[model samples]
Target: MSAMLEVVGLDTCYGRTQVLWDIGFSVAEGRTVALIGSNGAGKTTVLNTICGILRPRKGQVIFEGKPITDIPAHHLVGMGLVQVPEGRELFSRMTVMENLELAAYARRDGAVDKDIRGVLERFPVLGKRRLQISGTLSGGEQQMLAIARGLIARPRLLLLDEPSWGLAPMVIDAVFDTIKAIQAEGTTILLVEQNATQALAVADEAYVLEHGRIVLGGTAESVAMNDEVTRVYLGGFNPRGQ
Candidate 1:
């Protein structure tokens, strides 16, 4: 499959402090690619750069055969590159339906209501709480709303950052299951996750990041078996808890 998004020699910084160094990876069309590592490993930095939230000091971000390294973050959404950021980032005071509607602000289509219904159908919990304030929802529900909002934009490639953060194990399982369902629907994904075990289980390919650089890249299964990776990222346990 052709690559949907590719990052080459990416270097990003916050002021003079560089957060990423020569980072690179690609997400293939119709596949799930994961970037997994420990905290402060620059995993989120990579996603931010791809989403154009953080400008890369060097390197290129190629999406759909074109260089988007210089594009502004807001413009990328209309081009089908959408991000579900680390925090749910929901409008706390807005109704669930309102939050979803705002996500389509860049869209010119008149079928937004229909699209909203379609997306809400996938998360019946959100559908039930359509009129409630988003901030009032539980943690898992807020995350669901965040993802649902991203879908409202009709993304061709979804960048998911820490979808399971701060949730119960059961909720994390549900989140991963939802990700699989989304992928099966034909949307490619570039995921940044701290749960190496769960992330590898769902990813076809993965890159291991350490201190802002890619330290490992391979099929998820192979990376999972690496002694160092097992010790550092997987806590010496296999994906199935073996």
Candidate 2:
């Protein structure tokens, strides 16, 4: 598959504090690419830079054969690059339905109503709680709402930052399953996750980031089987060896 988004030698910073250093990676069309790393390893910074929440001071961000390195965040959404941030940033005071409706702000066309219907259908729990304030929902439901909000924008390339951040094991499994369901519908995903095993399990390709640099990159299966990766990321279990 061809690359849908490419980050080449990216260098990003917040004021004088540099967070990302010469970062590079690509997400291929129709493929789920996983970026697994420890906390503060620049995983979220990569997504922020790509989405233009933070701009890169060096290198480029190429999307679907065009450069969008310094494009404004809103315009990037119009081009189908949507990001679901690390904290599941929802309008806490807004009702679930209202929060979802607000995601259409980036639409350049008239599919808002239809897209809203589609998102509600995909997440029936959100539909059931549509009238309730988003902040009142449980953690899993909040996560569902967050991803559903992103879907309402009809993104071609979805950037998810630490999607499994704070949830129960079962809830995390459900979230990953939802991600797989979304991917099956042809939306390419760039996923950053702290749950290395689960992230690598669902990924077509995986990259291990350390201190703001890619330490290892390969097919998911290969990376998972690596002795060091198994020790560090997979809790020291070589599943194949067991």
Candidate 3:
């Protein structure tokens, strides 16, 4: 499969403090790629740069065979490169329906309402609370809404950052299940996650990031078997039990 998104030789900084160093990876069309790392490992920085929230000081972001390193965030959304950022970034006062509608702002199609209904139906909890303020929802519900909002944008490549952050284990399971369902529907995904076990389980390919650089890259099965990954990320629980 051809790459849907590529980050080649990426370098990003917040002022003079560089957060990413020659970071590179690619998400293939119709595949789920996981970028797993500890917090402060520049995982979110990578997503921000790809989605145009942060400008890379060097390197290129290629999407759909075009260089989009200079495109603004809003324009990228219209181009079908969407990010469900960390912290769920929902409009605090907006109703669930309102948040979903606002996500389709860049879209010029009449199907926004229809898409909203479809998304709400997929996330039935959100459907039941369609009129509720987003901030009032629980953490898992807010995460669902955040992803639902991203889906309403009709993304070709979805950059998911920490989808399971701060949720119960059961909720995390549900969230990963949702990720699998999204991939099964043929949407390409680039997942940046701290939950290595879950991320690798759901990903077809995986890269391990340490201190802002990619330290490992392979099929998710291989990454899961790495000693360091098992010790640090998987809590010494080897999936292979070797």
Candidate 4:
């Protein structure tokens, strides 16, 4: 598959506090690539830079062969690059269906309606609760709403940050299954996750970032089995977790 998104030497900051230091990674067409690290290791910052919430003071962000390093966030959305941030940010007062409708506003074409229908159909729970306010839903449902909302934009490359956060094992499993389903439908994904085991399980390739730098990368299995990773991210090489 061809490359859909690429970042070279990305450096991002917050005010005077520099967070990301010379980071770079890519997601190929139809592939799931994961960036896994402990909290505050710049995982979220990486997503922010890719989504244009934080502009990189250095380096390039190329999506679909177009340079979009400093482009406005809205323009990036129009280019089929959409992000589902951590914490499942949703319109609390809006119904599930209404929140999904917000994604259609960025469409450059007519697929938004179809995408909405597809998301609702894929997530019947959301369909059943379409009229229910997002804030009233359970944490799992809220996460679903967040992903569904991003899908409404018909994104070619979807950026997800810590998608499994604050959910039980069962709900996390459900979210992982949903992510796999979406990947099967040809959506390239850039995932940032703290759960190293699950991240390696679902991703085709993986990158390990430490202190805002790409420390290691390979087929998911390689990084998952790496000694350093087992020690830091997975707790020793005992193989208790798969």
Per residue, candidate 2 scores C-alpha lDDT tens digits across 1-242 of: 66999999998888998888889889999999999999899999889899988888898999998999878999988889999999899999999989988898657678888888888898999989999999999989999999999988888999999888899999999999999999999999999998997898888999999888888998888888988899888898653343
Candidate 2 lDDT: 0.90
lDDT of each: 0.92, 0.90, 0.92, 0.88
Error of 2 at 234 (Å): 1.1
In candidate 1, stretches whose alpha carbon ends up further than 4 angstroms from where it belongs are 240-242
Scanning candidate 4 in windows of ten residues, the lowest lDDT window is: 233-242
lDDT of 4: 0.88
Query: How do the residues 77-166 of candidate 1 rate in per-residue lDDT, one tens digit apiece?
Result: 999999999988999999999999899778999988898999899999999999999999999999999999999999999999999999
Question: Clashes in each model (backbone N, CA, C under 3 Å)?
Answer: 0, 0, 0, 0
Candidate 2 residue-pair clash tally: 0
How many residue pairs of model 3 clash at the backbone?
0
Displacement of residue 108 (Cα, Å) in model 1 is 0.5
Model 4 agreement with the true structure over 1-242: per-residue lDDT tens digits: 55899898998888888888888777899999999998889998998888888888899988989888879888888788999999988999999988988768766677777888889998999999999989999999999999998888878999999889999999999999999998999899998999887788889999998888899998888888888898898767523345
lDDT of 3 by residue, 1-242 (tens): 67888889999999999989999888889999999999899999999999998999999999999999999999999999989999999998999999998998879999988999899899999999999999999999999999999999999999999999999999999999899999999999999899888888888899998998999999888999998999999999865444
